[model samples]
Target: MSTHVEGSTDLKYVSDEAFIDTGVRKVVSKGNWQQQYMSLRSFPEGDRNCYKIGVTTGTKYLIRASFFYGNYDGEGMPPTFDLYLGASLWDSVKTSSSSDFTIDPEIIHVPQKNHIHICLVKTSHGIPFISAIELRPLDNSTYQAQTGSLALLDRLDTGVSTWTR
Candidate 1:
């Protein structure tokens, strides 16, 4: 299930209400260009909250998680938390205090099981929250990792704009 439900014609989003029994849905105080970033799900009570996604075993997929803190809680401080792929530690989500700055962490993984769990662990620094999560299927031959999953470090878009081109 997805935390946010807005989608374009090419994509469709479903609610996470049925998949998760915790967290509160909130809208960001500041406006965002993307509709999905306007709303988020925050976990306050639980030490860890997870969203389970079903996938074909051995299929390669790109999993991305987005976090945008538009000061939704009225507090100016942005929280730092841990993100987990199943039981393994994926990465740390360090959010900027700037309302416009969005942190997106992506990973290319092939799950051995039928379901993959994307979990958010609360750190003492702040509460854990998530803006969006997306999974894109990839060809088995693409993004071949030597040993384990590949975590995205940086992505550069070098294509020229229409006017420049």
Candidate 2:
């Protein structure tokens, strides 16, 4: 399920909003996402803005974080920051030219513990902010690899022949 990090404390849902930077915005955009999005939490002022999500240990899952600037700060500038999964760096959120757009990054992994830590850290450019977070369980058969973490190389279509037979 997706969690909106405004002011929720439901354990089954996303808890621990009492300890993060808070910001409210009313953004009108062409995309439907901006409509459901009501608030955004920042990380420049806080010591550490993170969410502890409960999950089955040893289970594979996909976690995603989204950020929508929407010019909430009235500065028309999108922030650049880093997202961390547990102690490892996941991805960096970059700035967008428009406030109506959003930046979403996701990771797939098996947690070593019963809980996973999702954190947003400030960079040298701007403060970190998050619009939403999502955690989904995946079947073990999906994304099997032979060694360490696998990286995406390229995607090809087998239906279409590229070379002469």
Candidate 3:
């Protein structure tokens, strides 16, 4: 099977500014021109994260990412992050506020230039913390998903992880 993904910087427009980013923990620099993977400001007690990213429009686009988050004082996924694509935040999974997710393998089709904008928004009692995020073109791993628990798939499930006490 073949998949279309947005790979490396072909025609990049990012910046060259790096910041301490008190909210996300690790240090990060703007991608290029107006493009960046930024962690804006912190919440309050430090329980969430936020970011801003931009892309040129009119091209078929696909991005793959893995988010690594830190833990808090038994509150949950430590620093809970709210993800926003442009101004519209995605109300998917979790509490619509906090989620620690693996790459869900999603592809976004672009219809125009300077048309797509993504914001990684976080909301918590404080600022959220993140290690690193890998956003690039989709690869073979994205198209190949292990279904129904294949022997090669290294995963385990309780089969009833949602059982109530």
RMSD list, candidates in order: 2.6, 6.4, 12.8
lDDT of 3 at 117: 42
Q: All models: lDDT?
A: 0.87, 0.66, 0.35
lDDT of 1 by residue, 33-89 (tens): 577788889999889999888889999999989999999999888999999999999
Off by over 4 Å in 1: 1-9, 160-165
Model 3 Cα lDDT, one tens digit per residue, 1-165:
222222464534222123224342343332331122232223344332334444454333454333332122234434445554445554321221233333232334342445444344544333433333323443334434333111122335767666667
Order the candidates by TM-score, highest first — what do you get?
1, 2, 3
lDDT of 2: 0.66
Ranking by lDDT: 1, 2, 3
lDDT of 2 by residue, 19-125 (tens): 33343224434344533344666665663467777789888887767777776667767778778887887887796857467776767788878988888788777
Name the 10 consecutive residues with the lowest summed lDDT in model 1. 2-11
Index of the highest-lDDT prediction: 1
| Candidate 2 residue 80 C-alpha distance from true site, Å | 0.5
Give model 2's TM-score versus the native structure. 0.71
Per-candidate TM equals 0.88, 0.71, 0.39
TM-score of 3: 0.39
